[model samples]
Target: MIKKIIFTGGGSSGHVAVNLALIPHLLEQHWSVQYIGSEQGIERKLISGLEDVRYFSISTGKLRRYFDWNNFKDPFKVLKGISQAYRIIRKEKPDIIFSKGGFVSVPVVLAGWLNKVPVIIHESDITPGLANKISSIFATEICTTFPETTQYFRSKHTRYVGAIVRDELKDGEAAKGLTYCGFTRNKPIILIMGGSLGSKKINEMVWMNLEALLVHFQIVHICGKDQVNHSIHMHGYKQFEYINDELADVMAMADMVVSRAGSNSIFEFLTLRKPMLLIPLSKAVSRGDQILNAKSFKAQGFCEFLEEEELESERFVDMILGLYEKRSDYIINMKKMNADHSTSKLIDLIKVYT
Candidate 1:
């Protein structure tokens, strides 16, 4: 029996959110759960007071593909993380290790492989992250969000599990969300999220053109924690520093969403069958994985993409209007795309491997 499982990943909301979704499923089966992640990452705060889960600190850091001073420090950091992971794994003696794919997950995964514990990795993006790519060799199963991801991994071990989204997103009603956001049932609602850390560019663009957007639609802007006050003033927009347990309500209520192309947000948009306008980060060093994630869904007609470079006030407004005009097409495509039940499939796979 799989008595215990160790989840490894952290550095972004994308990594932490998967674990949050999986926790209830694991508990339903009476499996003891523990988390191994960077002490400084968002996971620490998100899981700080969780029950029946042990959290271990690891000294992990990202290795930039570019030449940089930070790259020089990564080797030492990874080594330290590996040592900490080694100690934690030896002590926990977990039967299975589940990794959600981040640099922070590498050390614990390596330790699990060395200890002969089976490791399962879930890649949430259309493109796999560096940690998932390297860890694939040691992973017993490679679960992916999209079918296209199989081409990147060693063929036999990979499976398309779709994206595992929070149960709240799957269970909520759009009407409830609309009411919470104070929107009239007949009004077209627009939801804008810049990601967990917030996007300065997206915020600025919306601020500059707030009046125009308000003319046609009511907006619920999750401006991230830092920009809440400024974002509220910038457009007199209804803003939340963070939505807490209300994300699903907000998502369901919106007629459309404008968001950064982060894997987690994109998958959430798809899960809700919400039409979206994507603004991918243009910076080179950030991995800009969002661009690839957005392009993949766009190809399937599930959502529309707007490159950050091309995102002007006119273009942004035009895309929103276009989505409204062709709303039925977007809804049909979203339903087709949402046909896959990724979370339940993933839980079943874990049962098999365990």
Candidate 2:
């Protein structure tokens, strides 16, 4: 009999990439794949078009730490989601369930657990996210991205397996990237990314220093959806809301990366040996996971860190220049770093459980 697996995760790019890394392997092994996620989420958008993967959508409610007006209505949505997921699990009857934690995964996990299907979860940050923490009780195994995260999970099943890296990323062509932007090969390229939705502060800061940045480097800015400036037309500066098929090529041309420190994004850069200037989300906006990720990378010599507060200072451009000067060190450190992006460990567990 062919084995089957149901995958769940969503809400952010970080959560989505973990599941994606595993799907190709599962399919290669002839395991039938299914995905359960929110009806309207980034997960559905990311996971929908994959070959041989059947997607099931459920009504999920975001479980936020802070109080929101939706708090009153969210519980009902979550309960409904659980019921919907439970029915799907029963109908699909997959041999196992794999989840990378997000609010959507919580309901799917609980449903799979109650149905007695084996469930495994992966946590990609240095710390367990709130959704993962809540789902741990139902998970049979918890895979961690960082060694530091294992201690916090407190689960006998927790295993550290570094961040997942996509295989296609290794095929990026610098020439293809330059062709996309019509940029000169003489100037180094600086790629700036601020998550999927874009960061307002980073956008403002980049525009403010556009003249200074353009003089030193050609820039490819992935400024996120709806954040592009129509008025700014400058040579050697390419602004995109997002790029899919061309992303790998763009990455190949990037001499340095300026980005938010999400675990998925940073690990990809690390695997590519790209030196990065990390501007992590602050506690004011996030739970400080990005800050921790940035600090960890800095301590390991994989990247340089700048607090959001530091951007207001005139020295931000100088810091970027300084990071470029030390780029060799970052590449050397990252080259030595263990990269287990192939998902062999996670696949091993899946086979055992199934």
Candidate 3:
């Protein structure tokens, strides 16, 4: 009999990336694939592009740590989601469930546990997010991107499988990337990405230093949805809301990267051997997970980092230049890492549990 798997995750693209990386491989292996996500989430949009995958939407609520007016209504939505997920699990009867943790996943995991189906959770951050922390109780096993993350779980068996990067991302052509961006090979390219939704601070900082930055290097800025400035059309500076089909090529041509320290993005850059200067989200905005990821990468010499709290006008250009100067060292350190087998190892782990 052919094995089947149900995957769940949403909220942000980072939550869905691992599932995207795994789905193609599983499909090749003849495993039936399905996804459960929120009705209007980024995951739904991302997953819609893939063929052979059936998607089911559940009523999900934000699993917030702070109090909010919606918190009162969210519990009912979560309960409703659990019921919906339970029915889906009953009908699909998947051999296993894999979740990249987000609010949408909590209900799916609970439903999987209730259905007695094996469930695996992949936590990309150094620490478990709020949703994953709750889902751990129902998960058969938890996989982590950081080895240090294993210690966070008590009863669950946590495995550090490293980062799972998309295979297509590794095959980008620098020439195609340049052509796509209408940029010349005369100057080094700096790709600036501020997550999927964009960053106000990073955008403002780039705008402030645009003249100085353009003097030294060409730039490809993925400035998130509705954040692109049509008024500023300068030579050698390309601004995009997002790059879907040609993201690989764009990344291929980039000499260096300025980005948020999301685990998925940083690992892809590491796989491509792109020296990066990470500006992680501040503790004020997030739970400080990005800060931890950045710190870990800096400690391992894979990248340099600047905390959001410490972002200074004078040091922004200097730090980026300094990172470029020490690019060789970062590449050498990244080369020492053995992340090539992460996907395979994760697949093996899934099979073992199944």
Among the numbered candidates, top lDDT falls to 3
Model 1, 1-354: lDDT tens digits are: 658899988887788889889988888889999999898887877777577788888999785567788888888999899889988898889888999978999888888898888899998887788888888988989988777878888749888877778886777777777667766766688999888778888888887778898888888888876787552543325888677677877787788899988888887887788888888888553676788888887898978899888988888888988988887898898887536677788877777766
Give candidate 2 regions above 4 Å deviation: none
The candidate that wins on TM-score is 3
Global CA lDDT computed for model 2:
0.89
Steric clash pairs (candidate 2): none
Between candidates 2 and 3, name the one with more favorable lDDT. Answer: 3
Cα lDDT tens digits for candidate 2, 1-354: 899999999987778887888899889989999999988888888887696999999999988999899999999999999999999999999999999988999999999999999999998889889899999988999888888898987679888877788777879998999999899788899999998778888988988999998888999998888999888999889999877779889998899999999999999999899999999998897899999999999999998899997786367788888988888988999899766544787788889998
Q: What ranking of all candidate models by lDDT puts the best one first?
A: 3, 2, 1
Q: After superposition, how far is residue 21 of candidate 2 from its true place, in Å?
A: 1.1
lDDT of each: 0.82, 0.89, 0.93
Measured against the true structure, the TM-scores of the candidates, in listed sequence, are: 0.92, 0.97, 0.98
Clashes of each: 2, 0, 0
* Candidate 3 lDDT, 74-193, residue by residue in tens: 999999999999999999999999999999999999999999999999999998899999999988999999889999987557788899998889999999999999999898899999
* lDDT preference between candidates 1 and 3, better one: 3
Model 1 residue 224 lDDT?
Answer: 73
